[model samples]
Target: MKKTRIVILGAGYGGLMTVTRLQKQLNSDEAEIVIINKNEYHYETTWLHEASAGTLHHDRVRYDVTKVLNRNKVQFIQGEVLEVKAKENKVVLKDQEVSFDYLVIALGANAETFGIKGLDKYGYAITNVNAARRIREHIEYQFATYHTEEEKKDGRLTIVVAGAGFTGIEFLGELTNRIPELCKDYDIDQSKVRIVCVEASPAILPQFDRELVDYAVSLLESRGVEFHVGTAVQEAREDCVFIGKRGETPKELKANTLIWSAGVRGNAVIDNSGFENMRGRVKVNLDLRMPAFNNIFVIGDCSMIINEETNRPYPPTAQIAMQQGEVCARNIAKLIQGKTNLENFVFDDKGTVCSLGEDDAIGIVYGKKIKGTAASVMKKVVDDRALFMIGGTSLLLKKGKFNFF
Candidate 1:
């Protein structure tokens, strides 16, 4: 009797959640579970902005993936996934290939440059832990080099952030807190440093309530953050960004540091693997399985679920990914049992919270709007809750954000 082999790709939030739940749902004799990840650890994707801004250490966002797995039932494979041959039911990795009875694609996403020129070459993206570390070190290097030159280049201190989305805003919040410290360290006037956010949209945080958006904008403005709403980034260069407004010529903004937080598309492997997708995201069925293939399930950023109310796709968030993982595990278990009925995944609207530095934030939680320290506290609670969900109280206590002052 051959046990059903379940293979999960990438050890991100979705992948970990599915594996953690599946380990409990199925016995060792029933199914052989395998999880493949490029890295040996899993990092909190939500805390990436903090890591990119140098407010949080890169290692703090990650933990050993094997620590959370049940070794008796789960096998951890460390390798880069090249592609999934869906038709053949085999996954091609850099060094080896593996076949599975069930496949779960949770490969995460890549930075979406959105056809912007030179951004792929010059602009820094906060995609992963390594990318975050590189951005932090690059920013620090720019600050360190400011005084070394006899001719002071103020452009070195000017950081132009592309996109005023959640990531862009959160990163700016951390950068605002970090810049003052950096200026003090480098013996440079804080006023000389400019933190500008360029948004193509007419307003910042367009999906959020207007009042909360206004509050966020006001708070960031007070912290020396410049908001260039309705301005589009025309091009990115090695030393500057060109911006243009409606019916206006592109104006060059001289800044050595350009951090692009515009958007992210699902992993390219989706397209390469021949999955019918938009921006690399597969529109999975209500049960979280691929519409075309029942054996293959897609979760996290790699999967898209449409909102019936708004008739638009739900924004890929950590909250939704975790929820999808739970449902995916149950569905897979049902299939293995030769059951026709599978549970449908529905997202519970828990509201959203956007953090601004350590003690400032804004959000709508449980239908009520919150801001300042209260919202900030809720943000930390949210962060801790995610850890608790995947790894329980022990993991939460080990890697939780306890500083709520």
Candidate 2:
């Protein structure tokens, strides 16, 4: 009998974990495992904010895929996945095609601009390693050029961040921490630099409890970060952003940099592959497989499963993505081994930590509320834990943020 071919698309948390677990659980002769990703390295999606702020080096956020996957057990293909022909059991790539007995889609997410005007043309998003690096560089350029120009454009020194969600808040946290350093390096007065966060919601960090949210807002404000609550960005231009309150006149804020951290949708491939999806995420079955196709599995941001308690979909986080990968690998292995029983995905709520820069955070972990230094310490532990899970302690030591003081 021919060995089953198992192909996983993306080297993200979900895809990488699935490939790693399957390689260990199944006998080499039982199946041919393959992982396809656009990049040769896997990045810590959670750490992109730090990268964008230049607080952490971009190299620290990425790990070579080959370093973690066993060459003898898993085959690695570096290519962009164009589409999935699920009915034919094939995946099309720019350079080649592959057939699979079991296919996993974990291709991740892209920024959702919500049809906002000029957002696509002017706003920056902290989506990937390269994009983060570009934003960092752009910010630095603006600061450096401010001194060379005969007429000073204060807009060059102002930074406007749209959305008060996790990505936005985390990035603002880092930006607030980095501003002093930037001011010193660029010979600009610290007071002259302005950082503003505009949110459509009434409050920031909506995931946290109201008390913690208030604390976070106060902390950020104390650091000279401005919050424009209950405001929406109407448009983004090369040198300014237009925002206003509901039913109020729009006002323009001049800022060379506009970072949009509002929303994210699944990779476009899900829809392109003809799978029914809401914002490119398929409402996966209990077993993590797509309802439309038995052989196809969707994980990470591309798959949506509802929270039983709230009747709302759980926010797609790295924790859930990694867990889904483990369950996905187990089911695929069982199918290959002729096991009739398949495991359903059950997300364990370990808790969540929203870091407020290097030494501050807020979280609720293991049914206990944590904030300030304790929460920040827990956040570092969580970061290190993720590294340990995917690439072991050795990888953690090389890339982990161990400074939890």
TM-score of each: 0.98, 0.98
lDDT (CA) per prediction: 0.92, 0.92
lDDT of 1 at 84: 97
lDDT of 2 by residue, 279-357 (tens): 8889999899999888889999999999999999989899999999999999999998899698999999899999999
Candidate 2 wrong stretches, greater than 4 Å: 150-152, 403-405
Predicted candidate 1 versus true structure: per-residue lDDT over 267-313, tens digit per residue:
98998898899999999999999988889999999999999999999
Compared with the true structure, model 2 gives a TM-score of 0.98
For model 1, the stretches where C-alpha displacement exceeds 4 angstroms are 150-152, 403-405
Q: What is the C-alpha RMSD of each candidate to the true structure, in Å?
A: 1.4, 1.5
